[model samples]
Target: MTRLPASCSFTQALVNVINVLSGIGLLTTPYAVKEGGWMSLTLLIIFGVVACYTDILLKRCLESSPGLHTYPDIGQAAFGVAGRFIVAVTLYAELYAACVEYVIIMSDNTSTIFPNTSIHIGGIYLNAHQIFSIIGILIVLPTVWLRDLIGGVGASILVVLCLLWVGAVDQVGFHRAGTTLNLANLPIYVGIYSFFYAGHKVIPDIYSSMKEPSLFPLVLILSFIFCWFICTGAAISGFLIFGDSIESQKHANKICSLQIAVCTVVIITISKYALTLTPIASGLEELVPSKWSRSYGVSILIRTALTISTLVVAMTVPFFAFLMALAGSLLTMLITIIFPCACYLSILGGKLTNLQMGVCIFIAIVGFLIACDGTYSALIR
Candidate 1:
């Protein structure tokens, strides 16, 4: 029954949504296109349309009950306590996976800048990627202790502009015409595209924060439209510039290393890593008894532990594209597509027409299939 203060303006809400949707995902779009070929850009468009529809579905669910504020609140309203737990876990896991992606990005880009760098500490050797990853974790640790959010919106957009500069102003011309399609790898593209539109878990919070919640739908629409173009532009331009050879996320970094693309990615990842992990850290703190959790030392301990864990995962499974695909297919699919429809139908079934019910069921089915397909594809790769 908790409610957020109504403070966000329409423009603020739009910017917030765009920021969340256009994270490290933008940098990976070309790599995703390379994975499944140029024809797979259709998946990006398809996912954008469907994910936007589900955002509306989530809004409808929130409107059905005034008590709903957070995503878990919608879940509790839809199917009670178990529903809340499911939504909360899925959302947190997705955020944590995103943190891992951030670390991997920073590490990859750092290595890109200093290709032969390495370090040795206590007789244990660390290569450039591992050393830089540890440094990234340390750099972001202090940000986790702060309460305010300093996100990476500008750096992501800067990356798109950098791509353009690399292709046009620089000599990296858009001459490589890629293949029309490749069915075998399309599932990987699905997961990555699914990752592109995964801001749904925060929609309820954004709606609650709005000065006029009714304008929330407009915010969602505009946000999706804007981000769609950004993702599409990056994909089309990156693929054309780099072609099929741009097979991994690191290659996206390689696209414009001279344009300080790696530097931008490093900055974006560093800025976003703590902001992304803070919610999960706060959630864990809430689990401890109030007196202990309120202690400054305890809070720092929890946040640092979380950051270190993500660094370990980043170092262990360092394949950025495959990991992102796995997270998108397994986590983003559930959060952005399946659960929203399920909750909407559960909460508002009585008011819906038969067509509405059928459509929800159909969308849920398609989301589930994509999740399974993409998860398997990502894992095997």
Candidate 2:
């Protein structure tokens, strides 16, 4: 592919990177801490390092070949059509899972705002959570019809500030004497931490849009470090405030300023479903003939079908944190960690020094273990 003109400045690209890294994962930090003990917080740092490294690997893969412009493109360059297919399917699955998580979170918070919400249709009964999940998706479904829009990153900052205010000014002291380590629950937190930096999928676009493409590595480093601090602060503050009783979506139940914070995230969650699913819908449209792909009716049908699938999945498995863990482990680990290293080694292995090859192999092994252990733990718990 011909090189596109670069127009995005350093600051613009930095913000875009942060926006991709920050998402519903912000709400689960405390729960993750509660699950694996305080020491498990280190996993966030470890995963951040691994994510940044793998992202650089992806950038190297892109730089090695001018034809590569996306994650699937990297896969194809490294292997063949099969590699592209696998990467595309995994990326789409991860995006779809994220949409389901958004529906679950929106429903979870919406029910908190109106606790008694419920409905009856014929012989079927729907509780507040179920009713709200349907409403949330219906509200979000139309946004997919409109193509161009951007997402937000301020939610991460808002959540951190809220956690601080509630703990410092509101008198929720940091007095919890949490365990130093709980090896039994370590896998769960590993998966949660992985989800925090699952932004590598979009790095190619960010790379191509950069006014200074060579500085992409610097941007990746800064974004990951920034996100790591946000996650750490939220984890410590949230655990200090809520302690052992802190479960997934725990912030939604807070009656103080955190309630406002939760509502803000809820709005973001509702708004993000369309942004998440649009790519998947477009990919499906591409599978059809060109004539049908350009038809508005066909486009709407694809978008509606994807939205309805997410709704069904969200309603079936309503556990927010668990669903996140499952997605992060099964899909995100591959997209963010395993596949990047694999592709880099495959595409550019001839140029790598011994140390570089060893490092890539080491990181890939660690990523695979984390994916397996985390996936099993998420399923069992």
Candidate 3:
């Protein structure tokens, strides 16, 4: 692909990255804050800082070659066709998992708002959660195939409003409970933090969109500073209100009319269905023959199959929090953190200084360890 036109201004690119970085994942951060108390808040800041640097490393790592539009292309350039295939598969797997989680979250929130919602077909009873996921798939089916992000700004606004509204309501009903946090939940908290900072998958896109791509570091720092304050406030405020009683999902707790807030979020999140699905669809399209890649029938079939498979997984697995944490541990650890460092080492070889090399090794080791512990905790709990 030739160099695309840089139509978006730097400010637009900054806001775009911010929107991608903060998604539905922020909704669960209250659980993390409640789990580790002040400790988790500190970790959130640390993670924010580390994320800024580590994600910049991804951009630098991609600098080893030009015209590398996607991770698979970079992988192929760095390694071989097999490496390319593996990277593509892993990226798509992560994306598909995310879409499934979205469906589950949307449906779960929908169910909470309407307790008695159910349907009976052929003498079988289905609750609101089950029905709404299917409904969600149908509603989102068409949007995913479209390649427009025109609704992105409106979606971001709704998400911010939902966060503030939920926090406001939780605070209004706030009552002090004896301070409590369990050490056992540290791994999960780390997982949540890792997941919350996950916008690395799109760094290449964000970088390419900027008019002054060389100044991406400035954008990274500024956006992260903004991210830390916003996320910290949201997390800590919710924790202060609910204390240790906060569940893995505060939205589902039916706290202080949270159901209504969740309803607003669910309505807003519908706009995001297409945004999340586009990457996965593009990944699928790459697997098809070039001649058939743009066939509308084939596109519909591919998307239909993708949607059904995701819905099936969502319905089968009710552990929303654990799954998100697991994705964070496994996908975020590798794709966002570990692999970038490893790739830098591989591409640059011994040209990097000892200090630079040591930093890469350190990040890889620490990320792997945290991911292992977090994945284990998510699985067990």
- The numbered model that scores best in TM-score is 1
List the candidate 3 regions with Cα displacement exceeding 4 Å.
1-7, 150-171, 177-181, 249-260
Q: Can you give the lDDT of residue 270 in candidate 2?
A: 53
Each prediction's TM-score against the native? Answer: 0.96, 0.95, 0.90
lDDT of 3 by residue, 57-99 (tens): 7777667667775666666766779867777677777777778
C-alpha lDDT of candidate 1 relative to the true structure:
0.84
Name the lDDT value of residue 48 in candidate 3: 80
Q: Where is model 2 more than 4 Å wrong at Cα?
A: 1-6, 171-173, 249-258
For model 2, give the 10-residue run with minimal summed lDDT.
249-258
TM-score of 1: 0.96
Q: 1-381 in candidate 1: lDDT tens per residue?
A: 122347988888888888788888877888877777777888877888898899889888888877877899899998899999999999999999999998888887777677799887899999988988998888888888776665757878788888888788878788776677888787777888889898887788888899998888788888888888888888888877887677575765575465377777877876777778888988898999988988989889998899899999999999888888999999999999899999998999999999999999999999999899889988998
RMSD of each: 1.9, 2.3, 2.8
Of 2 and 3, which scores higher on TM-score? Answer: 2
Question: How should the candidates be ordered by lDDT, best one leading?
Answer: 1, 2, 3
List candidate 1 segments past 4 Å from native.
1-5
lDDT, candidates in the order shown: 0.84, 0.83, 0.72
- Write down the RMSD of candidate 2 (Cα, Å): 2.3
